[model samples]
Target: MAFFKSRDEKKSEEIYKIIMDTLKNRGNQVYDLKVEFQEGVVTLSGVCDSEATRKKAILCAELAEGVKKVNSDPLLLSEAAAQEQAAAVPPAAPVSPNPPIQTAPPAAPSVQTAPAAPVSESPLETGFPSAEAEAAELKPSPEPQPSPQAPETAARSAQPSEPVQPQAEMQTYTIKSGDTLSKIAKQFYGQANKYMVIFEANRDVIKDPDRIYPGQTIRIPPLP
Candidate 1:
């Protein structure tokens, strides 16, 4: 049983570290994310700049070695915002003869919301028709049927709006029998030398690395 348990634990460690490292490199996040893996499943619960990063993080985890499955309900995303940010980026070449513009999907609620904010500063009233005509145009057409493409577009534009702070609340780990600092470091991070990471995270509880013993519980500090 002990041998089986050790192998399972090692598999978890490999999966977690490989995924975190992948995200750090691709996402340009400065620090390796703090991850906790058990069994063959991985949970990602953390803050990221935008929804693109969040989705990319999950995808990276899914591709990691030995990861059986991934749970991303805890993932936080801002898809609309990320898409807008990408759109806002400047193009390298100068605007030439009027080229075809990519119209946002009708399901993109963001275009309406975006134009609303800018409308206060600049007049957009002249382009569209009067209130009654505009309302009619905005209304869903007769045939009263759902568009086949609506669901697919809406699925792509969706983002996580729920708050996700409790992932860190009251969470801590204890040193068990036969565990060493290097081993704990390797489990939490990809490298064994990152034992300093564990030490630093639990500085208040740990007077010295050498003094830690079995059953000594400590707070799992937030990654720097």
Candidate 2:
């Protein structure tokens, strides 16, 4: 079956492509940058030499037309990349015999974001298969439709399309062995009895408070 991508889906894909192109085409950054767009949000994924380059790539994409916002993640670091980045960002400030270490202006410190820890074993380690994954995989992959390959392509590709929709936020949580409702409640909601909130929100998968297995994915709900 052809993967028939919806207009919005196609647009999102084109946004991703544009972001990738900008990052790679930039100031001699040769690595293939990756990108994803969801719900009016743009997420940049790839290896860059330094935090500065990653930030720059994100900013360039944000300026691209149809970009709601940029989410920089999977920002990888390698020593070689770091050296290349340092050389690129600050070109030897006037060769003073003793140049003071130029410091970034005082601003809100960037929030620390670490990549998700790799699972030592596959998802099958839990001995339970993913029902949601099974359902998703059953559908025929959509048809590849003609859409924007880049933001510039998209800008002139379509006329007066519907507003880009936002991406659904999928929250994930891992279960711990010997975990009980009260323990989960205490950790997630601050009250042992608050386990009911979690239990209620996840009744679709959680049969009982005592039955949750380690490595299970549970959905947490926002307070109403």
Best by TM-score: 2
* TM-score (all chains, Cα) for each model: 0.28, 0.31
Give one digit per residue, the lDDT tens place, for model 2 in 49-140.
66667677777768766778777766565678777767878665686587688998899989999999897875435766689888888979
Give Cα distance to truth, residue 103, candidate 1, Å. Answer: 41
Q: After the best TM-score superposition of candidate 1, give how far the Cα of residue 132 lies from its true spot, in angstroms.
A: 96
Which is the leading candidate under lDDT?
2
Question: How much RMSD separates candidate 2 from the native structure?
Answer: 62.6
- Candidate 2: stretches off by over 4 Å: 23-27, 30-32, 50-52, 83-224
RMSD of each: 67.4, 62.6
Per-residue CA lDDT of candidate 1, range 164-217, in tens?
232233347789998877776665554567677678768888889867888988
